[model samples]
Target: MYAGNSFEDEIAGLEEEGLRRKLAALPGAGGKLTIDGSEVLNFSSNDYLNLANDPRLKDSAKAAVERYGCGATASRLMAGDLILHEELDMRLAGLVHQQAALVFPSGFQANLGAITTLAAKDGIIFSDELNHASIVDGCRLARAQVHIFRHCDLDHLEGLLQTHQRGGRKIIVSDGVFSMDGDLAPVSALRQLADRHGAYLLIDEAHALGVFGRGAGLCAELGVKPDVVVANMTKALGSGGGFVAGSRDFIDLLINKARSFIFSTGLAPACLGSALKAVEIVEAEPELGAELLRRAKFLRGLLNEKGFDIPDEASQIVPMVIGSNEAAVEMSGALLERGVLITAVRPPSVPDGTARLRLSITLAHDEGDLHRATEVMAAIALEAGVL
Candidate 1:
């Protein structure tokens, strides 16, 4: 038998620190879910708009599969460029008010492609300290000079920009809505900083798309256009893929130079078609977006009333910081026992000593769900000394 002592020791360390992650099967859709053979009210998903189970998207996916086989068969550079993919690109570009867009297999790949392709070896990248892992890895892959600024601190970002202004191409990157914190980025401020420094700004809208700016994104809502926009169709769009939208030249460059886009198989046709239908729904039904925001606000208010120390953000993602990792894990278990499914986010996903439960609100959750979840969470948190 093969023995891996180092791997086992590392896993043991993780378990001792309450940072070990185990995958639980989620058999049902968002909102209501079945996990580990138990039904629970799921507040751990990223389906902010609750379109993951929509009949229209299902129908669109079925039709696309029938029309254009199941798989892309090859990369876009070869045989994977389906008409549905082109349609998604066009629609996404229009949504973000960009001149063009390119789809990738995932949001991770999209960020990797956009950042690594745009920021070359000699380029300088200014990234938010709390930016997603994808952006962090992308910067590393680019082999560029990366300066991480304090999260949402424009002054620190400007200082870094000024310090690095004398060199090669500069790229400023951030997430529109921080996935864990659920806080909005300073898009307008970042835009101004980019303009002042003559740098390119790339905003990842994975959590902001379909939930902000009438489903366009945070940049659109703030009335500021970045040099490039990256978004995931899997979250609010209820589809599976990511896309980068920007100037025609920029997108063409990515097509030619982005290894992630060129080497990886193209996005499946079903995902493209379903996302297309999702875009149409978002465009036609403004109420969906409005309702999402309302529900998020309501959930935040409930958490606040219970003294959970939730952030006063407008986004659908809410985090309850339970400083101790062990406490956070125990609280998550208690909540699960109470029929609520909120995952404990610990180190690596979050900063050390800042373990928390990341709560995601969805349009599918009614007022009743919100009330029950908050009540259960509050009781558990109080018992565990987390509130």
Candidate 2:
């Protein structure tokens, strides 16, 4: 279908642009992935609470496997609707104060389902400019006129909403927390605009579940309830999969109309079991949420003191603007050299020349870990002249 020396040609094309993506397998990229016996402090990964390897969560998954077996051989519309899936869905819905919830295979699927199912042929979808990749794709796939307002720009959003208030269904979508920038969306303002325009509000809270809202989301944390919400169990839940929570009628409609959910195999029982346990853990140990925030704050303060220009938001995602993908990658490599792991977020994942060293905090990391990581990053930036 395509011509080139395959891998080599692909690399050749990306080489000049400083973006050669190769699949180099690692033994284990769990809570902390290793390289050449050098432990990079894990600032990369969606396991926001480090629950990926949590013993309790793992045990629950094992128990579920013993009870329910390994794979889901059929789609939900067929023979794959396990009881565990329903239970997890119900509990997740309860967690977010939604009337109902449906479990999808991933956060991406949830976004795809929600955006595609709700908006109709005659609707106008008003979305945030800096929404997640899934939301962006979902908007593209959705059969509606998509109007992207500036990132969290309520004024611009209002302007668009006012212009489109004449007819047709209207919907607004945003992320509870912007993944790359680590900044929160203005959900409160967005909700007001939705109310004024009689539009529905949808939020993808993939990065804001456990660490935010006392274990809920920005909507709950800020006391702003959205009409629809989608989240991932992979990040803070420390499990795998995604979910959509909202009114029972809305969820019921998705169960019927969302092709991604209806045509896909149900979430495995182990994942469902683990997600249930993860939700339980969030409820039982609110201190874990507090600790994660504490660590995030500590890292943010430390990086700021080092003169790294970070945004003034309280989120686990802390980013340092390195200006070049090469510098960003080099900084990540340097941190690894010092026994700390950080990821370089470059173009496609982010805008070009805005490459950043993204550091995500979790309860698993302590002050010593934060201090060590900060010193390592600062040292690397100085050595690389990025400081």
TM-score of each: 0.97, 0.95
**Tens digits of per-residue lDDT for model 1 on 1-387?**
346678888899888887888987667778788666766888888887888889999999999999998999999999889999999899999988999999999999999999998896688999999999999999999999999999999999999988886657899999999988999999998998899889999999999899889888889888999999999998999889999999999999999999999999999988988999999998888567768989889988987898877778989898888889889888888898888988999889888899988988888789999999999998887787656
Q: Go through the candidates in order and give each one's C-alpha lDDT.
A: 0.90, 0.85
Q: Which stretches of candidate 1 lie over 4 Å from their true place?
A: 1-5, 34-39
- Which model scores highest in TM-score? 1
RMSD, candidate 2, Å: 1.8
Task: For model 1, give the RMSD to the true fold.
Answer: 1.6
Runs in model 2 lying further than 4 Å from the true structure:
1-11, 30-38
